[model samples]
Target: TNTPQPKRADRSKVYMADLESALHYSLRVEAARAAALSGAQLDAFKCYVATLVKYFPGRSCVQTYLQSLDTWLRNWTEPELPRSILKEAMKNNRDASHPAVLPTNVTWVGCQGSEPHFRGYPCGLWTVFHLLTVQAAQNGPDKELPLEVLNTMRCYVRHFFGCQECAQHFEAMADESMDRVASREEAVLWLWSHHNEVNARLAGGDTEDPNFPKLQWPPPDMCPQCHKEEWGVHAWDEQAVFTFLKAHFSPTNIYLDYTE
Candidate 1:
């Protein structure tokens, strides 16, 4: 005589089947919703969807699917992406001519600039991996990121870009920028300092001399943020500095009270 199986097992299987069907329907609904988005909103939605597919494949229960979707929506719909070097790079390069073809924010941060400082920036492959890890950390009971994704990012960052000090600094700055700082004033202060440092270096014959430089060979310290190393130093192009600042910072107000 064979023993009878418990009724609960049969019921559990049936419930699972129903859950799968619901999940299929929900995925379709989400796809439709994504289709309706436009501009940056649509782009971001698509990115999230793509990320979900890459990290979590195969069929899932309706409740699990919906929970993951909701969690992703909440985390990504914010004004900023989460903390990651790639995220910072993406934000900086969002206005670049080719945003879609590039890696996510962290890889972008590691790679976007032409400076020698950014030569070892992360590649697209590594970027994908790093992003997968971030997705895992963001997951909770309602959401779960596959451990595989995190491992992928780690492997890519380590293998492709290696570890460097500048890359590390860029990551730190990206983290700081996310907090929005005290105000635009504070942000500008940092931007201005960077500008001054570059200009001062140029004035001291640090950069290659050009016939038609944007600013004078030795630019003047026009803005209050500007500092002079010597009294006899040549005056710099105040206008050029102003233009560069405007392009980068887009200051809303100009305070000239620092002028003589």
Candidate 2:
């Protein structure tokens, strides 16, 4: 039996598709590199890979990256992988990227930082994963989906995120209230709020890309209704934040602007 091919897209549609593909390609590449670096630390993370192999949620974007990372080390997509494959990939080569399947030619648009040592991959990492939660929320009944996304993220960061301090901070943030998320909507809101808190803490820190200082997201210019009171001291209109998060993270809303 042959698999049926979908209808071909028109030129404009093809262009859009290419652009979106480019964006996702960059994200997958970033995840691949981050994971390889984190996963390959055998001595530092000896038991961590086993945990990921056992507990990371099966049908999510995170899983896709982890699984494909076994074979190609990037270039995304595959069904849920078993424990042995991941274990095999991590064998012997304590610091290899497996194969570097994601292309090196892509560029960041919304995630690009001003300086070489600044916001590039880390920024993309947060945005892409947040988009995953939003994507998960859109697919079906909230209860039907596993609540393991945050835990999965937790284990991954604990084992594999390149920056130790950042991972520790994320682990602490997860400790605060990640388990409280009960539904898809709450999951989206939880990540968004947590992200804002991080932004607030880093607003004037040296790690901040001077050109792209982190303000609590959705600044007044981006979403006026999302805020109330004053700049840097206002409370977010939670409903507005939810709406903004859904729309912003939705695949339909992301554009192909390959510029900083």
Candidate 3:
């Protein structure tokens, strides 16, 4: 008998199942525990956080989610941390900058891909950005919504993402089209489209996880309304896809059953 394809409701179920594993890898297994954030890294991370606080359009819960990150970043100071110098670095990009620190001692769950090096951080990172985008949409400013998040991503990718090649590719993609994003929904769609483009391009490539091969997201089986076959090519129903993405990444749907 053929196994039934899961519906939209099942989307969160799948992610939730992976949640514990993803968090463990992102926070513990793969992070560099000892060294504090570098000056450039701080700038990039701050830019990301500030962008979340200053842009995107929505309200209460989402804003609080962003603020929580802000609070955590602010409170992570250690006696060994170069406070004054870090302060100066943050000052340099007052108009455009941020920071990042690697956490340590975490365990793993859904993030252990086909091999030791295949998934982990990459999977968790995707979930992180998607959560922010969806949260912002539900409660961010009406203006600068998309560009804010896009720019934040650009800054972080350029300065902090471990995979230099992937970061460079994202930079090229942003240069080619990120400026086109002009609204809340556009921001979500822009990220989703770019991600799918990457998936299509990497579907059968070397880096793909054998057990998690990249497929066009929210595949036809997962959210049939989001896609359609036309002229022998799959065409996206933009609004439908957008709705699915928002739901899939919604903060409310994110499972909190795992440890941080």
lDDT for each candidate structure: 0.33, 0.56, 0.61
Instruction: Report the lDDT tens digits of candidate 2 across residue range 1-260.
Output: 59876443221111222333333443333233532333333222333322233332232333444445433434323433334444454333323454322222445445455677887556655665576567667764787544545555566566657788999999999998887788877888888888888898888999898878887777788889998876667687989988888777665565433322
Q: Residue pairs in steric clash, candidate 2?
A: none
Off by over 4 Å in 3: 1-41, 51-108
Candidate 2 lands at a TM-score of 0.63
Q: Which ten residues in a row have the lowest lDDT in candidate 3?
A: 92-101
Please report the TM-score between candidate 3 and the true structure.
Answer: 0.70
Sorted by TM-score (best first), the order is 3, 2, 1
Which candidate should be chosen as best, given lDDT against the real structure? Answer: 3
What order do you get sorting by lDDT, best first?
3, 2, 1
Tens digits of lDDT, candidate 1, 1-260: 57865232221011222222222322333223332334454344444444445443223332243344445555554453432422232221234343222111122222223453432222223222322333333332213222333323222222222344533543454345524433322332333343344445445352323422334222333343333445787443444543444432221221112111
Prediction-by-prediction clash tally: 11, 0, 19
In terms of TM-score, which candidate is strongest? 3
